[model samples]
Target: MIRSEQKSPFRVYRGATIDRDEIEKLRAGTLVGSNAFFSSSFCEEVAEMFIGTDPLAAVSPCQSPVDRRQFVMFKIDVDLNQTADLIIADVSEQSNFPAEKEILFGLGTTFIIKEITYDIHRNLWYIEMVVSSEMFELKQEYTDFVHGCLKYTDADTLFGTFLSGRSSDYPAGISHLQRHLRKMKFNDPNRANVYFYLACAYRSMGKYEHAIEYFHRAKLLQKGLSSQSSYAYADTLSELAATYSLLNNTAKALSLLKQAVTLFRRILGANHIDMPLYYTRLAYVYWQEKQYEDAHSLLLTALSIFKEDMTSVFAGLSFTKHTMGLVKHALGQREEAISLLKETLEIRRQSYGDDHPDVAQVYYSLALIYADTDDKRIAFQYAQTALNIYQAKLPKHHPSLKRASELVERISSYQRESTLPQSEFHNVQE
Candidate 1:
């Protein structure tokens, strides 16, 4: 009966149905529950339990399934480091089937989905995840942001504010924001902040009209906020522009992005950590306009700023890489674009885990790029995976969701065509 406490950190395996996209994105800095299990023995888990950092901690082993279709085989790489007390035990000797090394976790234990991929040949999904220590740090970071936002607010409201923006819990986020707003008078100092976040929540959920209305309201109420502050009204302008960009209103997006960039640069100066964010946003809009040169220039500026101190602005750094990757592709730099995108993908996985809309966006871009080349054979797989993540989180009519769905259908048709006889293919084309 080997235990994690008596040994170094290891891995466990299991077969699971991905029922929810929101994994371990904490509710009020507390863990949501799961029935996931693990083991060190092959084929199935032993009954022993142990503790480690990764919720994906290993203490069990199992043999591969004979029927791939019947059981989804997963190769989950779990990273368990020093953080919290999550148990993983190997009880192979104690089990009736000793070959099946089983493991267990503490109740209410949580985890994050870092990355996911499909193996066509093995019929397996590779979920590359590093967790626990990272999870605790991430949660603490978000909780600190909540403290900074609402100094006197209740813990529930603090957690609610986190949901809409960071956790991708739009339903819970909106409910909390609406309730919080009702308690505030029209002239309350925090009213603008509430309006700003409410707009953010609505935008995240594809409620563009409501988002726009609230953004305008926030803007009107934000007159007293210092223009010099990095988190002032300028941020609202940038967000409003993003919502417009999603609706194909590039003109509005471009104008607002320019305004936000100017404010960030002139007032806040180039020293602010978020300076690159607006520049990248502008570059994204520029790409849509086919102003490739302008976009490239802005991306260069953004990337340089990001390289100064990468650790502090990890998310911004990844976004810069992601944007630059797309721009590189548009410039016909396919190899460089793919490389940058792959780097961005790993960085985002390490930073956000799986199930984030940002992660899905990366998958979406990679699929589009691959679908256009000789790698079109696997393009459908990438597209389908992206569509799954998008479906779990994004709204039905959201542009990203709509585009991913269309891409999946288009790629699926291509895949089906490849399976047809030459004569049949011609018939279908006709």
Candidate 2:
């Protein structure tokens, strides 16, 4: 924590780092935020990336020598015209190394990547960003929504919201929410909302059993809730259903999803913006149960609504397409399925960048589809890309990494035998 009186700003500090692939995930069009404090510096080495570009670099964490090409430089350009919510400090006069100008930014600031350019001559990559208030506003809006459902709008609420939503720190989010949960009285109106969010955070971290426990707890609190919103209850059911499906409890999953869809349709209307989500989820369950006809019909309904409002549902449309693609594959519409899945791939790359586990998931799905067809070469390519991403983004022992690696090797073995491989892979469940 710094002086509260000091104006708030953001700067990317040196020594703060991610791996090469993780670093590359901050593509030029991406919007990213730091959950920790960062500092920036201006030195001759940093400016050498591009002649016109000002130097920005960081010192080494240890006294060891640093590699030039692999080094990262951060520069923050805050636009005064956009909003006056942030401040920037040159801090050149106060620097320990007076020759190198330094800049400092506040903790938890967001930035929009402007450009990332590589200089061949100097063997360096230069990344420049502009400070943006949009992410902060979005996070705040979500926090406000959470507060409206409960009572507190204090520091813990803000921190927990940031961890749970924007930063995706599920463990920290779980800790904060759980601490908050202990403070709520048994019959408090806010208890249900806290339990609901806690369930979501646990689910995100793949603690399915823990998620189920919280969902059940939240369901019990529903009787005590004073809020008239059926939204939380419906969402809890829908999410719980998905988790159940992942756990292979298809019967329970189907029942819960049906109940969720009924309540969602009644409350938000069949054509509401969020209806497509419920429709698609239910369709996925049907597809998993091998009820292809039912799945197709639900997907078509969701697709029609998805077209009416594509703006707000940008990411949701991709999901609808992806689920339908799986259904189409099951229905033997391979051509259409591949096209739909490819669209999903592109949209996810734009939204989540190239290295996200979700993007790797799409790659794996496409590989499975191609593996079923005569196109073994295309299958190999997709499988290999998925393997590479999974290796980089997932833990060493993650099930996804194991599965992706196996898929790649299996495809290779099929090609080596010069025969059409039997399509024994499971259907796309995500």
Best lDDT goes to which candidate?
Answer: 2
User: Candidate 2: where are CA atoms >4 Å away?
Assistant: 1-169, 182-189, 227-229, 391-398, 418-421, 424-430
What's the TM for model 2? Answer: 0.63
Residue 28 lDDT in model 2?
Answer: 90
The sequence of per-residue lDDT tens digits that candidate 1 reaches over residues 217-315 is 988766555643345678888988887877768899999888888877777787666788888888888877778899899889888877775655877
> What local lDDT score does residue 147 receive in model 1, on the 0 to 100 scale?
71
Which of the numbered candidates is closest to the native, going by highest TM-score?
1
Model 1, residue 19: displacement in angstroms? 22
Q: Clashes per prediction?
A: 29, 3
Q: Which stretches of candidate 1 lie over 4 Å from their true place?
A: 1-146, 151-158, 227-231, 418-430
* Every candidate's CA RMSD: 10.6, 8.0
lDDT of 2 by residue, 384-414 (tens): 9999987775556656677788888888998
